[model samples]
Target: MAKITKKEVEHVSRLARLELSDEEKETFTKQLNNILTYVEKLNELDTKDVEPTSHVLQIQNIFKEDEIRESLPRERALSNAPDRTDEFYRVPKIIE
Candidate 1:
């Protein structure tokens, strides 16, 4: 991999609307290069037998099974509605 140069760092900072001093540019260039070097080292690892996963840990669904249960009656549910039909609440039309 090509080493990150100060000019490339300066260009990126300008595109991001950031103002960096000469020292900051030098620092970022070195830091980016070091990160690339480390990533290059990872290419030497053998991952052929490793299975790809979204997460490192084994995950399973923790949810309980759904059960049928008694619920509030429709009349009681619509008791406080300002406007309601026999089975549902009513609201003013705002789309038109």
Candidate 2:
């Protein structure tokens, strides 16, 4: 089993600005040791023939093709604007 020292746990807690009680520190020490042990076990796996991957499944972009297309005319684009000038939307002044 991997062993985690009380001092190491205390150091980590201090770095994270956590104030843990004695009982909590002991609990965390055991938990961290267990996590290390689990990782050590994983190191025993034979992955020489396995391929490393960022994700388990294949991923591909699902976006539509980026091609030029006809857009709405200016009159149609601004038809529903609550306020507008000749070529732009008009909004209330926000800054002095």
Candidate 3:
């Protein structure tokens, strides 16, 4: 028995707002059925003793410790700015 039907393909195409031709619908029905059939074969596997895992390989965090550090002075930080006030950078108004 076919896993997918032409009517089901047409219904999905309608839901997705796609306009498929008769030939395309026929092609997609066969293709989707083949994919489902292949996936169904996985049910025959013996996985009773297999352990479930999120990833195939082990993973570990490789990060340095965070520490407090001195920040850049305001005068030096604004030295390369195109526009600035006494204590802040001046940017063009964006909101009405």
Find the candidate with the highest TM-score and give its number. Answer: 3
For each candidate, the alpha-carbon lDDT, in order, equals: 0.88, 0.90, 0.92
Off by over 4 Å in 2: 45-96
Which ten-residue region of model 1 has the weakest summed lDDT?
56-65
TM-scores of all models?
A: 0.41, 0.43, 0.45
lDDT of 1 by residue, 1-96 (tens): 557788999899999999999999988899999998888887798999987788877888688669977889889889999999779788998699
Off by over 4 Å in 3: 45-96
> In candidate 2, which residue pairs clash?
none
Q: How should the candidates be ordered by lDDT, best one leading? A: 3, 2, 1
Give the TM-score ranking, best first: 3, 2, 1
Give the winner by lDDT: 2 or 3.
3
- Predicted candidate 2 versus true structure: per-residue lDDT over 1-96, tens digit per residue: 347898999999999999999999999999999888777887788999998898877988689788998899999999999999998899999798
Enumerate clash totals for all models, in the order shown.
0, 0, 0
